[model samples]
Target: MRSSMTLFSTRTLPLISAALFAFSFSASAQATVVDLGVANGYSAFIFGNIGSSGSSGFTSVGGSIAAGGNIYLDNYNVGTNKKPGSAVNSMVAGGNLNTGWGTLSGSAVYGVSNPNATLTAPQWFPTNNISKGNASTLDFAGAKQQLTTLSGDVAKLQSNGTVISQYGNMTLVGNVNADVNIFNIDASNLHNLTLDLSSLKSTASIIINGTATNITMSGGFDNFASFANRTLFNFANATTTSLQNVGINGSILAPNAAFSGSGDMNGTLIANSVSSINYGHVAMNGSGFNTVNVSAVPEPGTYAMLLAGLGVLAFMRRRTPARAPQAAMA
Candidate 1:
């Protein structure tokens, strides 16, 4: 007679292994948690050019900068406002790099040849840390696809906050105890509307989705520094985003928009192109997205294999005959 313990051991071992394999495969399928990939290290990740012309306003970046097109900086500063003792790549451009008077506290990398690129009166930390032919290492093309997918996924999330409008001011209120909160607002009402986010908790992940193809925001957000790291403003369908005179706190995700803004932003900025970003003295900080939820799903083939294994185990258990007792021997 086959012992019950032997049957259980043989059947349960394979099931456990199959279950674990499926779980691991699903966990690595798609990431729900927001990840910027290669662009996470940069404060400003632009798919197109940086400055419109050579006479653009002075700009200061708190972290690294990566641009797909040419980078024209009249008076600029990079890798200065970051962590105290960290010196990474200050500037990375896929096109030419034209600078008049600026300071790069780290290395500089440009794609074009010497004639198309110029670096004049720029003070380097390690004394002229300039290089060429490393633009492909930044991988701006991969970042664009990743950010676009992220924007779409985040926009599809369910809204969990309330939007109240009164006297040209909009207030977004969410539960403090929730892990993730989403809010949707129209792009038309964004201009000149004061945003109130004082009721939101600092530890929670906040996502603000816009509903327009062209967005122009000119308002200010209150109590933004508290939840800046875990907050994201997703402009998924925007073709052009104009942020004028607004002190933005959360990270801006506009993968397909031409971003033209004035004033200072305190988070990561991702855009398709930059006509001009007049930051004056104040610039974008490295307050990037630091937290979010991640969902895991198994592939169809792995799921099917697990189901077949279970079915075979059940059939074997059912087909097994019981052992007969011999009482005449006693």
Candidate 2:
């Protein structure tokens, strides 16, 4: 009896305690995740430069802009769609800000002192929206690392939605009840696709991971703007990603891809470089890529602990002797 009690205390109890603790911790703890770190606030977060496509001289942005390289602009208007109380700088250039003429609704910061000699500087609207600073405002190098990691991480998620290809068109349908709806598509098959998100909940996030070397999103993705705030398009393996004519709804996460387009991108634009772009609008839905955790899965070690605890209880039960029957006399 003493031996059994000792076993229960020394081995079984600890195992059971550990198992319960691990399981409880795993069940209660949840990781709160955000898509982009500091880059989320920008209309365009480019690792390289932001230049005009030579076709359109008027480039407008609804939010703040950040670039690792130079910002070459002929006629740029920024911070048009920003919140009235937003105090952040409208432009943060890691290299230089070369502009012939433009108006910034907010302050500007640049790394290089000298802009293009042809233009003195970009005009600041409201007169009070002028704040000049050096290049230490934003960490572009750090943003590059985080953006690359996000691209790869989002791609690893298993697809929960179906990508149906029929009649030379692709259709994406998602489960409305699901917290996250993931879709995987190749650049080859994503032509004239329609976003059937009528069933999806407004708060649920949608992740579209595209695999290709060179990807062009044009004509497809009708009505993507309505769900753009809750959507993220991750092009992890692309070297070049271009948008043409159509209005882009979601944020583009292409860390290695050179982003160019004559279209209007309405969400957070993260890429290696952006050139010849037309419009970069801040996420319209307000909450860009909102993700919520509905359930939690225990870790491998936690499962092992639980199993071990149950096994010990079973072993102890088998080892213990049964109590003999006693007769009562009247």
Candidate 3:
């Protein structure tokens, strides 16, 4: 009886351990999805801190603009003023605004000017629900921390006429002569990866082919484009990102760095701050890619089921009869 009981315990323990491990892993993976919180409202552009110097441009933002810091729009247009369709979106600022010579044609501008004042504030100035100096709705700190937890591979390519480097289910294809570095990542095979090009020249064009995967890029690119929508370019580890007259296409997730350049970008921009001289455009995606939805951990019922299963296995082991004592060995 004792021998049989021991055998049962040994076999069942391994199975129970495996089951527990699988369940935990699944839960952790599901939890990686992060919620963008209030940042989701402004699809076009969102920034946490805008320096006192501010920005100036005539570019158009397709969606809304939400700023957690002071907005210095000295000489810029915030909406469309074309011939037939002369319309503007909403602009919400959490801090003060130094509206020098800029013109806002949006439906409303919140957190700026007093509602009852007679001064000729921008159209729809001091809209309702305008909160000033309030905390940002987006969880900047949480998002940065989440990026650190992501794991992936790193691929480096040397541009010598035609550079080709493959690493861990990802391929880099580009012509060094044309100064183009393209990354073709297999999203299904490799979920997380980073392209380190800090050592390469900044004149190279960087392109990414995967969407909705964990990917990060270090160093600067003269031109950047993405074929996949909802692709996130995390620059959280870098202190600053400089785009010198380069136009990029993709969402930038830089919670800690400041973006400074005289270039233009088409896609959502979530960063600590932004400073631009020329036309800098950040167009938000309406496909719900700018925001994330993090799922909660597995429910208590899941844990209960695992415990119950282990308990039943133990009970069965006790009930099983031990093999009869074998005859004395020769």
Candidate 4:
């Protein structure tokens, strides 16, 4: 019902504030610094999709960031859809896992930037296998760029004041000072999220089907440093689709960044700094909230099961006790 992330802050300045209104919604800001206080007005505004879908049964993609101590938001999609040769016809629907280990379904549509953009099955419907669709298969054909996933670990000593950290993945395209660590988790100093190619960034349409993998984006000995995985950057004209799990170690910077995803985050999330979650809109019937708890470490039951199985096999092989040596008979 709840997620593991925490509250965040945003700000903007005077001149920077004016510029935010000038941005074109065709894509994200080219410059990593989303100056919300600047006065740079938009010549080509692109934020036409921002507002709660009133029974439209679909969440409109949107985004925002802080600059010069001001928050700036103007909806924008992505650079390229992950689904290659697929359709970009925007659709809607839902119901998914809370731990983020499943596929999503319903009417997930897509749109692309140019005819060259390709769409793939994994990119279009990542939760396809571990999950299902409500109406039909996922159709992310038109998406220029889609937020795949935002996960990592704190690269420094995080505290209650800051709820962000350095997250290394396909989304790390710019020089973003992610200092929004809000999760108040106290545990082993590190963050390890099961990763794979699809979990990373994508330059072209990439299909990711449970290519179960592991990657250590970053971590440290700091208490909250393990949970300081908040705030991300999406530079202007940037694409890390070919992004794989990498390492991270950095600090929080002003003018934090923002990113949007095609992944179903269709749910409401609540956190007290322990953990955070991301999923689709939470309907009474639809599944929502993929939790990430920093306090409780999952038991290594898999390892235990494997060891127990091995012991059973060994016992069966040696059904009788060892016989004593008969050297004295000679």
Please give the RMSD of candidate 3 to the true structure. Answer: 11.7
The digit string of per-residue lDDT tens for model 2 on 217-274 reads 8776776766777788889999988766666778888899887766676677888877
Show where candidate 1 strays beyond 4 Å. Answer: 1-31, 84-87, 112-127, 189-199, 277-282, 294-330
For model 4, residues 93-163, the per-residue Cα lDDT tens digits are 12211111122322232222222222223234343333223223322221112212111222121222212
Best by TM-score: 2
**What's the TM-score of every candidate structure?**
0.72, 0.75, 0.51, 0.18
- Which 10-residue window of candidate 4 scores lowest in summed lDDT? 267-276
Q: Residue 329 error for model 2, in Å?
A: 16
Instruction: State the C-alpha lDDT per candidate.
Output: 0.71, 0.69, 0.45, 0.22
C-alpha RMSD values across all candidates: 6.7, 5.1, 11.7, 25.8
Local lDDT at 120 for model 1? 39
lDDT leaderboard ranking: 1, 2, 3, 4
lDDT of 1 by residue, 122-240 (tens): 44424357777553467667778888898898877667787777778777788666677778987454754333545556567778899789887777777767777777888999888
Better of 1 and 2 by lDDT: 1
lDDT by residue (1-330, candidate 3, tens digit) is: 767667766786677768877886686566334333444444333445443554532234545565555555555555442222111334555555555555455554444323322222356454342333223343434543543333121122222232233443233334444334435443322222333444334455443433323333322333234322334454434455545544455555555556555445455565666666454533233312333333334667777877787787778767877668889989
Arranged by TM-score with the best first, the candidates are 2, 1, 3, 4
Between 1 and 4, whose TM-score is larger? 1
| Global Cα lDDT for candidate 1 | 0.71
Better by lDDT, candidate 4 or 1: 1
In candidate 1, clashing pairs total: 0
Cα lDDT, model 1, residue 184? 92
